[model samples]
Target: MTTWTAPAIDRRHEPYRADERTMLEGWLNYHRDTLLLKCAGLTGEQLRTASASPSTLTLLGLVRHMTVVERSWFRQRFAGADLPELYDFDADPDAEFNTVDTADAEADFAAFRAEITAVDAATAGRDLDEVCTVKRRDGTANEISLRWIYLHMIEEYARHNGHADLIREAIDGVTGE
Candidate 1:
């Protein structure tokens, strides 16, 4: 059987000057593409290769994680979509990361792309300042804005992409900014 490889990604350059919304979305997209670029052309086994001993982080795991993050923030928390967890975190807190050994890399990639589409649709036409109130486990309600979600997503992707850079480098010695 042939090994499945992730497709190539053409990341756009974020503009130096733009409106607030444009700047945030542009940087988010750039970082999103950066993560995929780090995994491009690698087979499923290669994508599942752990960074180092004791850390199960992998390119494929990051992809799964961000997919969950995208759905959790944009759909469940902000957009108020009633949805079940993508991966069974109850059964295993690190399900996404730990299940890579038998995961279908191609399907996971497709799901990630699909979640991004759904998140975009969910947030479309919503004002950046539009707020959503989430009930915490502690019985307190916290209000969050769409703008804050965007900023947080950018930070999440940026941190994971750094891990991806190292994992990709360890896999094949390919490195870049």
Candidate 2:
């Protein structure tokens, strides 16, 4: 059986001098691309291989986890779309990060890209200060702004991309931005 290999990512440079919205989105996209770059040219097995001992984190798992983050924050919370978790998250909270053993890495990456596209479309023309109230799993409502969402997602991607960097390095000694 042939394994899926990650394709190359063309990462764009984030602008240093840009408007607030542009800056936030650019950084978010930059980090997103960075994650893919870390996975680029790697086979499915390599992508799914764990990092150091005692940590099950994998590049494929990071991609899957980010997919859930994009979908949940933008579509489900911000746009109020009635969407279910893509990875049976409720049944297994870490399902997205732990179920890479048999996961189709190519399909997971595709779904991640699709979620980003959908969220971008769903948020187009939406103002940064536009606020939405989301009910937490505990049934408490909290208000969030598009601005905050962008920043939060940027943080999320940056954190996971760090993990990706280490995982990729462990996989084949490839490292750096």
Q: What is the C-alpha local distance difference test score of each model?
A: 0.92, 0.91
Among all candidates shown, the one with the greatest lDDT: 1
How do all models score by TM-score? Answer: 0.96, 0.95
CA lDDT of 171 in candidate 2? 88
Per-residue error (Å), model 2, residue 87: 1.4
Tens digits of per-residue lDDT for model 2 on 22-55?
Answer: 9998999999999999999999999889998788
Candidate 1 residue lDDT tens string, 1-177: 238999999988787999998898889889889999999999999999999989999999999999999999999999999998978899999999999988999999999999988988998889999999978889999999999999999999999999999999999999998
lDDT of 2 at 134: 78
Cand. 1 Cα-lDDT: 0.92
